[model samples]
Target chain A: MAFFILVIAALLVSVFFNSLGAVSLYRFPDVYTRLHGATKCTTFGTIFIAVAVVLYAVGRLLESGENRFWVLIIHTLVAMMVLLVTNATGAHAIARASHRSGLAPAKAVVDRLEESCSRGGASQ
Target chain B: MFIFFASFLMYLLLVWSGSGIPMIEVVIGLLMATVVTFAYKTWHPEKRLSKRGLDPRRWFGFVAYLFGPFALGLAKANIDVAKRVITGKIRPGIVKVTPALKSDVARTLLADSITLTPGTLTVDIDDAGAFYIHWLYVEDENPSEEQLYGNFAHWARRLAE
Candidate 1:
């Protein structure tokens, strides 16, 4: 029963965050802001899903008094780690490409990149 | 180094408490993870730190944004997609939704998020971080790229605000 509750909570949390990421994609004033919200929320949501699985496996392990819990927990954790690294790196690449492609912040008062590029041109 | 050790120790304690793992095993596990992290850092020393310095306050704001208005927007999108799917109202076209994000990290996040969702698939990303989206249902009205991205950008800023 407790395991069921945990699983349900995990699902709900994951869905909630996924929804949040989608909404933020719309609300964010600029691409960078959208990226920040989507990446962090999705990462956290996926982590919760893994945690739920771990909880279920651990419960089973305790009930059976077996060593299978280690397998589930460790493997799930490794998977989570892979997700963390890949998602983050992917986000970085997208942001870099976006910046290079000339998308400006909708409400920027300062233009540091513009200044630097102009400075480089003048130097040449 | 101190911060990393402290975090590892905290993780060790948590795992040991929850999993009923032996302290020695927990320590070993934590050590292994730390070693892996160190190896990754060594392999990519130049990319270790973010060009924009980390700020905790901004991070918290970003989290709050995700948990609030962003969620609302996703809910709406979900409903919209469901409606389109059920009604068979999808035109299904690939359209470019260019975002104005300055960071590669941010653009990747946006793209992945779009891909993960049901109705939209990210087909291609250009060098400038512009995403080509294949919508399951494109309305006959043919929404402009700016119009399409406008919804996403609004919620994204709120989520990361």
Candidate 2:
């Protein structure tokens, strides 16, 4: 019963964040805002999904006492670690490339990078 | 040598329990790992694993950081971003942050952590090791170091520098 509840909760959380991310992509005005919504919401949602998988694997291991379940848990964990690291790196790369391609923040008043760059390229 | 051993161990783990695999396959995997490691070393002869980064104490600090500040910051940033999405109120801006960490790896880790947190995205790193981050809500035109890093820099220094 507890396992079921945990699984349900994780599913709900992932669905909520994923839907929110989709909505944000539609709602936001500019590229950066949309990127923030798309990247963060999906990453958070995927983490919850991975957590659910881990919890399920652990529950199975406890019930079955099988070595393969242990392997499943460890592999799931390694996949989660890879996902977390790669997601962050990929988002950073995209944001950096977008900014370098001259996409300005829509509502920003003070452009610090521009200010510094104009001042003898202090922001290389 | 370290890279070779680590890669071999990783290849063994990838075989995973070795229940059904033949002994010949294991030997082939070992040979492949060795070849890959040799190729990597030949391609990057100047790249040596830094002793400080390999310290056990630094590994402990990194584990602590993943559980402590990084986790807390991730949760907080997620909530903050969620609220901003709901309210449709954001004051986005790019700001420069100069962390005290001198090591390139430490600075890269800090930048990656900041980028992973929902409300901030690392946009650029200058030659002086300063970060320009795109913050979802810029509270200050000129944020202090504490505001920028919030104990992350300290952890990065401990773990990598």
Best candidate per TM-score, number? Answer: 2
| Candidate 2 CAPRI assessment class | medium
Looking at model 2, the pairs that clash are: none
- State every prediction's TM-score relative to the real structure: 0.50, 0.93
In the range A2-117, model 2's lDDT, one tens digit per residue, is 87589779989999887888888988788777778887888888888988988887788778788787677777777888888888888778877887788888898566776776
Off by over 4 Å in 2: A122-124, B17-22
Writing each residue's lDDT as its tens digit, candidate 1 over A46-108 gives 877887888888778778866657667877877876786687567656755665577754443
Maximum-DockQ candidate:
2
Candidate 1: lDDT of A20? 69
DockQ scores for all the models shown? Answer: 0.05, 0.60
- Clash number for every model? 37, 0
- The weakest ten consecutive residues by lDDT in model 2 chain A span A115-124
Top-lDDT candidate index: 2
Error of 2 at A1 (Å): 3.8
